[model samples]
Target chain A: MNTPLLTVHELHKYFPLQGGFFTSSKEKCLAVQDVSLSLHKGETLGIVGESGCGKTTLARMIAHIEKPTAGEIRYNGQDIFKFDKKQLKAYRRKAQFIFQDPYASLNPRLTAGTIIAEPFIIHRRNLAQDIDTDLENIMKMVGLSKDQERRYPHEFSGGQRQRIGIARAIALRPEIIIADEPVSALDVSVQAQILNLMKDLQDEFNLTYIFISHDMGVIRFISDRIAVMYRGRIVEMASNQQLFENPQHPYTRILLSAVPRL
Target chain B: MKASPVLAVDNLSTWFDTEQGALKAVDEVSFQLDAGDTLGIVGESGCGKTVLSLSIMRLVPTPPGRYVSGQIALNGLDLLSLSEREMRKVRGKAISMIFQEPMTSLNPVFRIGDQISETIRLHQGCNRSESHHKSIEMLRLVGIELPEKRIKDYPHQLSGGMRQRVMIAMALACHPQLMLADEPTTALDVTIQAQILALINDLKRAMGTSVILITHDLGVIAENAQQVAIMYAGKFVEYSDVKDLFSLPLHPYTKGLLHSIPRIEGDYCRDKRLPIIPGVVPELSRLPEGCRFHDRCPDVLPICRNVEPALIGQGFPKRYVRCWKYQ
Candidate 1:
């Protein structure tokens, strides 16, 4: 209704392949190319593509995990890249990322409590009465038990480890969460639990999400708007129903039809 | 009566003697597969689906894994009774396996041509050039372009899709009667997954090879398999025709799994929180005394906590469900 919470224009990212030991190659692999989209408050933007389609690169650029090779990303009408040190720090607090691999993303040695509390410590945002209280609340918020705080990452199941990852992402109360294939690693049953939990958290916190997955069914379930990427380009972008019902792009149609119908 | 079935697994119980008691990876699992039939095993991780296939191939390690009690007969040949050296003769010749991660399964150091030819030479006892030509033919059959040139490439030289195709080529090199494809497309992209699955289906029909396709995706199973087995906590909770399993799932676990998958077209899953089967799979060792699924199952009765359910077949339309409710 109002101005978009975040707007990306002409976004591009390229990784240069090293030709030799001491040579910087002129040949660069274009990971993302000229992608533009706007995300409003509380909206879930689903990006679907096959592997090596650069959807993850787009997510990384949006979350400020990686700098775009070319383009403009404005957060609340301010250019995120052009922002000064203080502004960049403030922007960091507003956006967070949930990686695809829960196992690799989480620190193995750290307890569940310390992992969730990491953001608070990094941003130095003293949230709530005490750190333990916040930890307990975050754990419960993500459907984890308070008793699990003492356990390491290896002890938790695949689904529970993902919850810990989610808990850490939302601990800072970010405006946007860039989740790259969050549930792809989990079992179907556990995937349901995580998707439901994400929705619940989205409703409660009014958090905007950039949910990326190769799975069409998962993308359709959680997204308000969908973007179909093919070979580092956005082939199509439409609302959830429009994308499913009347897929305009050939790639989109291929993707939709590719999902084995039940 | 019915071509004598390609494979018959009678009460297959593959247990491991772990330090934390015996890990019953597979327990009392029984099923049959006809020639050219695809039996899809759908289960969560650690549900013994992989172990079941390994047991079939006689691939499970003896020090850790042991066959508690079972009869695995492939075309009237008892697999468990065969010695290790004897089993080797049957492995790639009678039965071959395709693993989930093609990258890991395919030897990176060796050329694709050599790898595929090795399978051929080992099983069929073909000469050097003869095996190479046969492997090239296999590659071409799997739809890999320029089989002659591509065969010279290493595993890493090819893409994920190409690598999987290579695996399929290698697995089919000897034209084994039974193929155990464990999560064959789980590591692939959806589009590539579609291609690989279609290729497998085509190859199966042409070669008349029976496949035991193990994966966690219900959609994949529904599309590729004739028969479906729903495994939980190391036992098959439901076994039925593909159409019947999807249309009318019997066991609580099957129902839960079906509902859990978000649909592509329907708005049912969108209206509410995705219906999930709560709680994790209990440890294989030190399992609950009663129904293994009782703790997580909805509509569970008090008796479910105290009673174990045997898999019983329902008359008319051939389906078996292991649940106290069915019992």
Candidate 2:
């Protein structure tokens, strides 16, 4: 739609097998190989894969959290790697990441308010007057009370910690969020709450989501379209209905079949 | 009298004596598993599924974790009455357990063969060469390839799935009459999860061993267990046949748990709002006055806020539901 919100061309990330200052063994592990995709303005793109399949590497490269060995990422038709310092900062501001482990992602020492307000402070947004009000609103939107702002990460449950993570991710009102298995670490009942909250937030903010998860049920429930990755490449990409119904690739079929149904 | 079940637990309440208060982790949980039948304990984290299993195995550390009151009978023998020395003998012989994380469970320094054979040596009193030979057979039984060579490799040398298989081999090495698998496949991939589950099923069938399968996934419970117990806040909220429970879940907690999961099947759309239980599982230290699930129950009555409901059923004939409405 409108030149696609984000695009990746032949993305490749290779991790060195052995690293030393002098040794150049040339043996590398292909984490992400020849991955390519385009994100729409306000749609959830699900990337499903088993552990060690390099979906995280792809997400990191797209968010510019990690550098790709070979490929190009264009945000609004301009190559993000070629961006100047200010342009990079602006791009980073528009794109934020939510990690799988909420406990690890958040700083344990800081209060919830401080963690959520860090984005605004780091972006150099002069919201000293309205920052408190904004933080409270974000917390409320994530199904957390305003009183919880004073609590530390250790005080919150797994679900509440994730809510804090989401509050931080959306603090800057980013157009795109690359969430790497955000609900994987939560319980099923809590997972449902977090998933519903994400949907509500997406509708309210009109944000695009790059949802990555290993659970087929979660990906099916959240994504508009799905990409099934095997080894280090996308074996199949299709609309949610088509992928679940048809699933052309053998690996995709295997993945769909592996999911235990009630 | 009819033959007794392989394992029977009655009014078992495992509590942790904390400075704040007594945390009832497994409160008055009662159930039984027959020969070769898998009794699946379905619950989210901190719902006491793991604690119940640990209580059965008599593995809970005593100073902190004390059984308030109950009986844990394995093959009609009271396990709770056993001394630590005697319980040690019962552990790997009559009962065995496999934990969730295989990587952490397996000793990194020990070779796979040594780990598996150690159980055999400790339980069966076999010599080193005999134990080593039995270890190879055990590995082969669990479908590990090249058992002779793979047994020499350390825990780190194996993949996550392979390590789990090794763990299974060690657990089954003693050929225990009953097995406890606590989230055995939780850390593995879905495809590997399926394989491990299928392997457990096949092993149970072949060995005629009663299994207590505990997990958070309803799908796993539906596929694996014959009888199912839905645990919440240290109690069995719902207990019934897997088919009956899935077809007609009675407890609000059980029903909410069923509806909460995003099924990978028909009529489930993408990105639509899912049915959710209102809040998180309450901390055991500060559980509500009356019903544990009343705060999150969609169909809460005024009585539910003040009066707790007992698990209502006659000896698990059809089903048991712990709800005021049912009572």
Candidate 3:
């Protein structure tokens, strides 16, 4: 498809299982195994699964937040793992992450403006003067008032805090945004608002998204194509239409049917 | 031709005395639930669905929470007039509750078996050994595999779904006449949530237990509840049969909630934005003067902002709605 924007090849992540005193051996928990997917330039690819199903692990590997035990992540035809120090730092600027819990992901001590300006302070060292303007634009883009920047995370509601999180994600104008269950913690009414905001921002910036969530409704609402993960493996991958209308895999059918619809 | 209701709540108001003012968490809400019927109370967070259930159970903390005025009757007996000691007997024996987060609700220090057995023994007055046996049976009934081994496992040893099943087992140990499930599946996965919902429905059918299922998901309510109540800002905005409610939702807030949810099966609108209620829920202490939802109501009238509308029934089978549009 015209040389995909990003390609993940055979990603595998394993954590060592802590054995009891009597059993002294190397045991591993395979969090994500042989998971591979390609993301187009301006389309959203949703990875959906239940808790502990390795969706989060796969997202972390794709975002380069966590190093895969065995795999290759190619961004713009170059392996991300093989990047030198300078190249890796540049790659970090190209991709940003929005965490699941708005309450825990943000710093409680810092004001919203300071938090949004952090990416610029860390990455664009010479853009200190433009940080304030950049932060204000990003906040407005995410539907937050300019005055809200002075308030702490605790002062804002869950939906507003999530908006602040989104503002921070887009502050650096990253090419790819990996949002992991970004609206799952908010109320239903507010969830719709956040999802709508995300769609608008995606179009305005022409951004690619790797949206991860367990909610079929949310995934269906936001994604162009979806990859279903089960037990650390992608059981089915298809467009949103095909996956919802004619699910091929039994597990996929079960997952689709399990979603409570209005 | 109407059977006696298993539960009838009249003029129930639960308020909390916060630092600012008296916060009416649950306003004067009234509903009658027949035995074996599932009544779903659906609302967003801070809408007082949880507080309504808590008020029914008399579990609202005393210092901050106070029952303004209400009558909660279970099987024609008023629970509000009962003493603390007497209410304790009615808690686990006649009525039991399942909370939202199973992780925190289950005592981590105790084994799964001990917690279930404790409920059984306390309510049924059974001996230790008998309670243990019943606990195992309850666990098996909830479809937990390897109940014999799982009985010895602590709450931490189980997954989220398994922990919820243990909570169910504890709640159903005595076969209580009424079960109050407050967002019981909110914390679990979709597959596990489906299983839990099915199990609850099956058990309710088998035991003839009426359920007051509290959740924010209208979809869940449609599948499980026969009667549905839509709450907004601590008041029952609409109450009707599930089929009728879904087919003909009267209140603007109810319609807003129904339309706000994205459907999985229907025609996909790829680019269309979801319709959302604009304003946030008002704080309990400073609720809007008239209709709690008038600020966000699309069909709002001048009267709606000045005077509160009473919940009035429309016709047969009692379809109740509190809105100026209806008046």
Report, to 2 decimal places, the DockQ of model 3: 0.71
- DockQ of all candidate complexes: 0.73, 0.77, 0.71
Better of 2 and 3 by DockQ: 2
True contacts kept of 2: 0.77
Kindly list the per-residue Cα lDDT of model 3 for residues A1-262, writing each as its tens digit: 4999899999999987997778965989999999888988889998998888899988888788899999899999999988999999888888889999999999999999999888888986786668877887888888887888899999988999999999888887889999999989988899999999999989988999999999998888999999999989999999998999999999999988898766
Best of the two (2, 3) by TM-score:
2
**Which candidate achieves the best DockQ against the true structure?**
2
TM-score of chain B, per candidate? 0.98, 0.97, 0.98
The candidates, ranked best first by DockQ, are: 2, 1, 3
**TM-score for all models, in order of appearance:** 0.98, 0.98, 0.97
Candidate 2, residues A1-262: lDDT per residue as tens digits? 3779999999999999887789976899999999999999889999999999999999998889899999899999999999999999999989989999998999999999899999989997686978989988998999889998898999999999999999999999999999999999999989999999999999999999999999999988999989999889998999988998888999888888988889
Candidate 3 wrong stretches, greater than 4 Å: A19-24, A126-129
Residue pairs whose backbone atoms clash in candidate 2: none
For each candidate in the order shown, give its overall lDDT on alpha carbons.
0.92, 0.92, 0.91
Task: Single out the weakest 10-residue window by summed lDDT for candidate 2 chain A.
Answer: A123-132
Count of backbone clashes, every candidate in sequence = 0, 0, 0
- After TM-score superposition, the amount by which residue A39's alpha carbon in candidate 1 deviates from its true location, in angstroms, is 0.7
